[model samples]
Target: MTKKAQTPAVQNGNTDPNTLQLHKDPAQTDAAQIAAMALGSVAANAMTARTFAKGTFGTLDVTECVMTLKQRVDTTHDGNLKHAETTLTAQAAALDAIFNEMARRAALNMGEYLEATERYMRLALKAQGQCRATLETLAGIKNPPVIFAKQANIAHGPQQVNNDSFPSSTRIRAHARKRGTTPDELLEGPQHGSTNMDDRAATTPTRGHPAVETLEPIHWPRKPRRKSGGGA
Candidate 1:
């Protein structure tokens, strides 16, 4: 007997071969069904492969772009930091130079001040020496005898003698005689006579002479006062 052709299921006006009925002898139709199933699986595998490839490529591109931007930003930030460091270093150096210069100037000024002070001290010492010398010279000139004799003559005019200048011991003897006292008694007391030779000469000559002797005390000049403040 001859068999009729089998029809497949229909959906949306199309027949689906996958849903077609098979004969009772399934082994004879197994090869054809397996081939169709393999073709459908290949189509699905290709679609999956395309999707994975597109996603992987897009992810890789985005990652590369982000890395590049990060690298640029990091480089820019590093450059800014380096510039700031350089500027700070320069400013520090400038400040150091300024301080060093100030110290140097201060040292120079100190040196000058010390030198001026030393010069002033030297001048003052020189002036003091000159003053002392002048005073000593004046003291030597002012004969103490002349002053004593002049004072004595003024007090006791014609009655005083004008003997040769005597030593202090002789003058004390004469003074003791005039006072009607012993030389030893006069010498022993606190009222001692002048020991200076000039004083002895002046007083002794006036005891019994008519000679008018003039005596002047030596006058030492005073040191001149400086008008400027401090010697320098």
Candidate 2:
């Protein structure tokens, strides 16, 4: 008796052999897989530490070298980031060179002698785009986006935000409490007469900027209208 040929697994009732089939490699055993993963992890960690050391050698401070292991880990992180930035910049330079060469070739091919103008031109365009994208990526990697939870509020109305680390009001209040005085007095500087807390509390000092002095609204005088004469 002859063994029948087995067909590849079909998907959605289709007989296409090109369809992808997901399965573990038959040659890779459980132990082999685990060992490979462990080896990869070890290699990655070694590379990271090596890169960190290379980056930190010239710039490493005595305090950073002698401090807690956690600080060393943090320095390692900075070193790694610096390495990444350096790598990205070098890659961008390489890409720029590649793009320039490709562009030159494309320009050369566009003439009467070269037959592969379209192909070279297309490749050059692609290279230029890739170069631009890589530089953009490098820029982003160098200066990552900063998320500001609170920003300076320059607009009008009650909605205001403080961007300072320590607010002036808080500092003033703290000093006032320490010196046995009101926040208003601290703000006004050395004054002979003390201001009433009731008056200060009654007036809201421009919500966001507490240090800014509030000015009274200017009242403009209106001009009188001339009376019209009938049939002049």
Candidate 3:
């Protein structure tokens, strides 16, 4: 009989229990990979939360800046409108003084000039009255008021946006009709108008935004009356 060939107890890539030869179990390796993937998912969730929180803070910061700008505009317009009224009051008083002067001296030429000036003052007062009315309307708008906004969310909340917290051109118009004065003229700012006396025109004083109509100046002739007897 031929002798049977002996086979090795351990195959290649197999571990021997008594030696350092190592082998991996497929199921156990797969389980370890799954656990690693779960840990990575946890890290990714943490990163995502951080990113969202960062953007939320940025939005809050921007909202704060917008509110600050609105405050400045509010203060500026408040002071501006009040100052305009006061200045107009002074001008009206000055015109009255001129009328008193005209009454004291009886010259037809001076009377005519004074009448023209008074007409300009009346137009100014009318414009001022409109401004006052509009300002009252504007001031009536509540600031930071609780307003409802439609949104898809977990629960209903007050609107976060400030729709009219600051003045736009429309708001600055104070709801006054544009019929009397152009919106620009109604809101004549500190930056408007000429200081030079030479530039003064015999017309209704109008200083405003650049868009305001440039009215043609009326040349109210302060022409001298003719002499009873003689020559030119």
CA-only RMSD, every prediction:
47.9, 20.6, 39.6
Q: Tens digits of per-residue lDDT for model 2 on 1-232?
A: 9854234322234343223222356889877765664465433454444346644443222222223333434766776566556666787777777777777877886777466767676676777787788778878877889987855457677763544575777676767889887755444433534364343556645767458787999999988998788777
The ten-residue window of minimal lDDT in model 2 covers 59-68
* Every candidate's lDDT: 0.49, 0.58, 0.48
TM-score each candidate: 0.16, 0.34, 0.16
Best by TM-score: 2
Winner by lDDT between candidate 3 and candidate 2:
2
Model 1 reaches what TM-score against the true structure? 0.16
- Score residue 79 of candidate 3 by CA lDDT: 59
| Residue runs of model 2 more than 4 Å from their true location after superposition | 1-79, 113-115, 149-232
lDDT of 1 at 216: 91
Please list the residue runs of candidate 1 whose C-alpha ends up more than 4 Å from where it truly belongs after superposition: 1-79, 111-232
Whole-structure CA lDDT of model 2:
0.58
The number of the candidate with the highest lDDT is: 2
Better of 2 and 3 by TM-score: 2
